[model samples]
Target: MTRIPHETSGEPNPLRALGLDTLRRRTSMKWRTYPEDVLPLWVAEMDVPLAEPVVRAVTDALALGDTGYPAGTAYAEALADFAGKRWGWAGLAVERTAIVPDVMLGAVEMIKLVTGPGDAVVVNTPVYPPFFEFVTHMDRQVAQAPLGPDLRIDPGTLEESFRRAVADGRRAAFLLCSPHNPTGTVHTAEELSTVARLAERYGVRVVADEIHAPLVLDGADFVPYLSVPGGESGLSLMSASKAWNLAGLKAALAIAGPAAGADLARLPEEVSHGPSHLGVIAHSAALRDGNAWLDALLAGLDDNRSLLSDLLAEYLPGIVHRPGEATYLAWLDCRALGLGDDPAQVFLHRGRVALNSGLPFGTGGAGHVRLNLATAPEVLTEAVRRMAAVLE
Candidate 1:
């Protein structure tokens, strides 16, 4: 298995710097001291190599020399199998699934399908940046329901937005992320039901992004929004990108239930057609056979996260890590540490670790920084060491 060099270290192992190599290679710098020795804890891509099954699948596809349009039922069948075996919310068939280029495309298309320009698209702030653009770029209005301090949705605020939109008689839609980005909140089943009921009652189409659903960490179960009662009426988008580190492959499935599913399937033929041949192949391999490798990767991530938590406690004790139930990203509240202005910038310039500025995740994310812990321990440890040195 061709893996990053840092991934193979032994016990007393230095933290494996997953993206550091790529960062170093791109910046033309060396480890731990190049102009402040920047450690990149941003970007969600894993430093580890592809799972063996994924590699084999891609290799076989390449060997066949068939890099044509990925029009087929296999990818959809694979997705259906994954949804059933993993989440237990059925009612999905291959015909109801369309192979899209990526989650973003599916999302933008869903919003466009459900609403027109000047209509409203509601999103929880501090969301994936693209959600903002997906709505605004289309000349639609964006309703930001910022999360409260607990890092969960402020249902009160969201309800207010819905009421306002309905009162104005404007069409509305919702763009939701499960195992949400940056914040790493795995929304509870009951919460999802509530959200669904809101959408149904308000006549808003819900576009649920479950791209990170496969990587629920810390013993939490990954609940598909559609699996909850009344959830099938919403649109669900999933991908192999996060779990298998296959974002470059660009394959994702958009499933609509008998209710929303039919509307989704009836989307423009341009969007409903097949996916990338490579993406389809990679996704199929990931869903059908990447469980063992995923387990190992999760174990590695769990260990890395534990190390991060312990170090933050011991060194940067002032920083708060909103408990991570899913996703490799950690939302660090650096406000308590008194890092002036933007902690992300302070960490980048002083601590030499590049983290996602919290402001982008939404209102409550301000003064927070998101760190990607999907790398090797040696790398993460070194990053923490640098961060601790700057603050300690």
Candidate 2:
């Protein structure tokens, strides 16, 4: 294991300074998508440097000419160790794990293993847009269940959707987004247990997208769906991509709960062949050796979340901003700002601040925009300054 420097081991701001001059040189879609004047904050990509262990792991692999095919259980075992240490999830059996190209793709494959085309899949709207796209691509019908007024999953609405999806007596599935995207709500243990019970009652299989499990902020507990009671029959898609700023590397793990082992075992061998060999190496090293660096990044994000709240209050006071308990996304209600249903369009054209338009997030998305909060405090301040100028 690589040793972290004493100076940075507990530095409050361990993440490197993310200045605009340094960031604009990158070619990632988030940086290169808009004109030079536009400050891009739409994508989930972080504006931080690579963790030392991840860099060393990738470099060492290249130096030894060890890059070949993805194999072995090192990655799974590493995640198991991390989960046990960080989240207290002791039941993550490595034997039931598999590597996939990415989270959404793994979800498609998992959905296929449990259901066939034309089967309905229940999902919360104002969700990650890919949820809708992937379900359509799988030839599966999506049963939309909008989150209630509080933007948290409502039991009544969920039960209603589950009832509808299984109404024809066909086996349907539920796609759960934990620490939900766009809004960033860390679904509580009780909520997850309720979902499990409902799924069990209706005989529906559950697939949890838990990629953000490690990014729970401010001491908020992130309850992995499979860790709660009644989650034994479900499957989870987890990855180091979001937490470690490795989206470009492309690797994720698919874990099957105890009761779902038989169905997961039937997944085709071809499924494991496509994951990037280097992705596995880097992600494995991240899970095993990047805890110190991750802790530092999380600290920076905690500060940024508060910084965004202050900036919003000072500049765009009309926009309703709620500090999320997890992840670095702020779901801003811009309806009061009179930016119309798609505030992102107005912000892009007038303020040159690129944001994710909320229209595609489904029912609750209108008059809202999802802001990425995993950047430098100054960048967030500048983003709001530009957005406020749109009104001027």
Candidate 3:
């Protein structure tokens, strides 16, 4: 990891001197109405403005009054180009790519399509709650594979779990989160390869959620699952929504490889005749031209992440983190703090900060909370200060 240069004296972070301060100043004027003096560090959204490309795309779409369904070939070329430039892998075969409303919808659809009722779907515990929600909601049996202390999938244990499920005739699919949410640990290419092997061995399909791929900070590279060796056999779901703050627009691209691709390729022919015109346009612009703004945004996030790490080390010692590799979400172990009951509630009602309780993340997430550091450094600093005051 590269260390950012700090000033010799009371070094001021460049992000603070940049647009972050301005953003906070405007947000503070109406923040109280939303959370009442509390920082909203719960959701996976940045407080920064959108990239110019994204803005221009949306604006142009509105200007042209092109509200109809998008043509198939338009965003396909953009996605293919983005994938090639970003990951150095290509041959996306746009014919197999389908636009979905969002990641959650894609996940649900994949689960239903891959497995049937009574079959088991494997997912690591302390994951993005929706992983569990999708399986259970579909009335399918869920196989919980808890992540180990490093907050990563334990291969040995995972292998055993898969064996048990297969023995029971319940094994069918695995729901995987890459650059995993909450914890923010980007899985190594080797790690993804192992997962592919597991899927091959157990005859289970893998559903990789890579929604947070673009949020990787400070020159950190994001690896697409399909880019990994033998990844062409797995399913990769990706989008520009998370990092580009296009969630409201509701668009995600699902790439199907030989193993899972063959199954998903029928999506366009079977359902949702075409992609959303607005989503396609916005996604195309962001991927094709958003690099400059993305670089600056990542720099700002790095500063905020560094400030939070320093503050946690100094003021809230003993709380542990896994060293975030991607995304603004920070998974913190607050068991040492011993804030009774849901820590999120305690912070909101008392500390006046809103954080996502770790409980929903699964077993290991019990004593933790997910913090979103996408806001300005000033807001995060104030939130930490208030938290310290409560604990002190």
Candidate 4:
């Protein structure tokens, strides 16, 4: 096992420290989904070691034979403390938060709280793929409100979508992805306030998926939706999974705004049964004691983001990539490569580089691909080189 440095000690970049040989040996979807010859950079999983605190907490619990159903509000409290110290927002009320299986499950429950089967759920297009899948699977219609040219929420477009969504007195819900996936646009407090106002005016409920909140890189600030004025009726789901690389540990919190407390209360009690007790312990430990490790990870990611930009400019000059303010995912515009609608397929077959096809991200996603950036710098450089070779 590689010796991961302690938080207090200055350590090398985590993303670069993990060797490719070690990574390929793992059996996660990111590594096993493709052939050995292909370079996989499509999923949200990071190729780094778990934070020391998280590992210690989980192992301690296992040693004591303490695996049982999750209980208590420790997870919520830990998150509340982290949010206050990190984002300077004290709006997280532990009393109004509930434990759920994961971010997507929490989102499904939040959407169900204020909406009924067959109602409309509005989403920003070229957004997360699961936003469409999970909502549709729940028997709700998905309305597209594609992002503006700058990839930020367009109020005019959003308002229009909201109007159409609630037509005929139908109750609608807006599913917001904060520090949004793929594109990684961090929503400002001002932008969230506007969304709250629009949702209020159009009578649409807002359910924010803030799973990537803790992963916001430099030059960006994450605004909790519930902290904004007029956002009292909104709901947000957050977790330490993304930041601590704890996705396999299924746990998340669904927090309701002051005005939506009643709706959140109506969530079925059985929903809490989905998360693993060990997952709760790991997530709680991450929120409370993983800050030092998280800080180190963020610094490494910032460097990777810059390195990716430079690599793209030199190898794939025609590809347009607006460096995102958050998340380890990079959305690349491959239209200029003349690879047609789904360029990812071309890269996979010709370059042996696996990337997420943009088509599933909904409208405005074509001629694009999403690449994961949470890997060793050498792996990222080689992936870009392989992709560029396809065009040659």
Best candidate according to lDDT: 4
Better of 2 and 3 by lDDT: 2
lDDT (tens digit, per residue) of candidate 1 on 145-233: 87777878877888887777666888898888898887889898888888888888888878898899888874576777777777777
Candidate 4, 1-392: lDDT as tens digits: 11122233365567866788898999989999999999999989998999889999999999999899999999999999988888887889999999999999999999998999999999999899999999999999999999999999999999999999998799999999998888999998899999999999999999999999988875567888999999999999999999999999999999999999999999999999999999999999999998888878888888889999999999999999999988999999999889999999999999999999999999889999999999888999999999999988
Candidate 2 residues lying further than 4 Å off, grouped into runs, are 1-16
Candidate number of the best TM-score = 4
Which ranges in model 3 have alpha carbons more than 4 Å from their true place? 1-34, 268-275
lDDT of 2 by residue, 109-211 (tens): 9999999889999999889999999999989999988888788999999999999999897889999999899788989889999999999999889999999
Residue pairs that clash (backbone atoms under 3 angstroms), model 3? 126-361, 126-362, 256-261, 257-261
* Candidate lDDT (C-alpha), each: 0.77, 0.89, 0.75, 0.92
- lDDT of predicted model 1: 0.77
**Best first by lDDT, ranked:** 4, 2, 1, 3
Q: How accurate locally is residue 246 in candidate 4, as Cα lDDT from 0 to 100? A: 90
319 Cα displacement, candidate 4 (Å): 0.4
